[model samples]
Target: MSDGAPDSLIPYDEIVQEALRAVVGRVLGEVEAAGGMPPGSHHFYITFKTGAAGVDIPAELRARFPDEMTIVLQNKFWDLSVADDHFSVGLSFNQIPAKLVIPFSAITAFVDPAVEFGLQFQAVSEVEEAEPHAEPENDSEQGAGNGVGSEDGDDGSNVVTVDFGKKK
Candidate 1:
């Protein structure tokens, strides 16, 4: 080839990202349909942009996180409602019950470390750089050990992490 590959006119990256986000929705919808308990040892660590559009969380939580927040879907969550573009669930923070509504677009990562499976996505919303926040302490009494899985300490071969950096 005389010239390098031309930049794609098609928005393949966006298409692929949206498709992966749908996978998250489908998995959550199945869990919601199955009475809110993930099948067997499959638990999730879902990270989302706290300030993204259509994200409805408590003001206190928003203030605390102010950037990104990850929640566990294992031992203690309820009223999970999954829609095509969003899902809502009830969780606890500091023993206080709260409801969170998160759009799939706001999600940045979805991981089920039980099987070392994960998906990383680029943030769908524009966000400013900020200091890293602390891990959320949801009321997961037995929530997959540390809530980020990897308890077995195996190499993370099953995780899917994509980097679509364009050629310089």
Candidate 2:
């Protein structure tokens, strides 16, 4: 990994990203099983690709965010449903309730500040071998507009980002 060129035999980056994405599923599943977040100040800020496959959100929300958006799971949310590969929930925006269905593959970041936990992923569409994007100015930085964090205002402790090269 220290070398400039990646190894051809192993898709180590993709494999690791997949595993981290699974952690998103497991955590969501746990919250679903418990009826809600455990009895504490625990909550989640899930940032995802709005345009990714399997993502379903209101037109207004899509129009507003277009590319990515972060949602907070705290009070006043309803209908928490978790599936093998996706999850859905109802949240309020400016007093208007909206239902959002997001596949685990669409998520880019997951953060739980109560425990300072976070996992970042590359939206499946962002790293397709068939499509290439311009490089960022710095290797440590993400592409323009890809670094938008949550508007939820969680004291941001450990946000993670994993770039598989394409996954939006």
Candidate 3:
């Protein structure tokens, strides 16, 4: 059979992306409901695109991260607020405090290593334009602290893959 073209019309990518973003929102909502990070667990690794629309990263951070960046939420974080379209959190870097506001649409990944749970997202597009600026000293780096549990099972290697691909 010749691998050519099929005639059909449906917006699967958008639908899947929307659903995945919801999962992020729901998770954050749960955390918010719990008042704060649960005992023995106190951080997150949030990776997102610097250029995504509605993303409100600091000017300095934009320059350093350029394309993408990961943030750590632990000891020195505060005012964590999650909203329908986005979420905001305050984190300290080198004794300097900075606020980060990220739109769910811009998040490319969310991982809670303490629980061995992680989620990967597809970037909206590669052609998206990003603003250029320098990252402030107040932006925290990724994976800077240690929490309670291992991010894996016995052997320390396990990954759960969720394929949102459409069946032909």
Candidate closest to the true structure, highest lDDT: 1
RMSD values for the candidates in order, in angstroms, are 5.9, 6.5, 6.0
Greater lDDT among 1 and 3 belongs to: 1
- Cα displacement (Å) at residue 12, model 1: 0.3
Top model number, TM-score: 1
TM-score: model 1 vs. ground truth:
0.81
Regarding lDDT, does 1 or 2 come out ahead?
Answer: 1
Superposition-based RMSD of candidate 2 using all C-alpha atoms, in angstroms? 6.5
Model 3 residue runs over 4 Å out of place are: 1-8, 126-168
Ordering by lDDT: 1, 2, 3
Q: Count clashes in each candidate, considering only residues at least 3 apart in sequence or on different chains.
A: 0, 13, 4
**Per-residue lDDT of candidate 2, residues 90-146 (tens digit):** 999999999999988888888787787777776564424312332324223423335
Pairs clashing in candidate 1? Answer: none
TM-score of each: 0.81, 0.75, 0.72
Off by over 4 Å in 2: 1-6, 126-157, 163-168
| lDDT (C-alpha) at residue 143 in model 2 | 39
lDDT of 1 by residue, 1-168 (tens): 546667789977888989999999999999999898999999999988787778899999877766677899999999999999999999999999999999998887788878778887776634323223423353233232222323323574466655565564
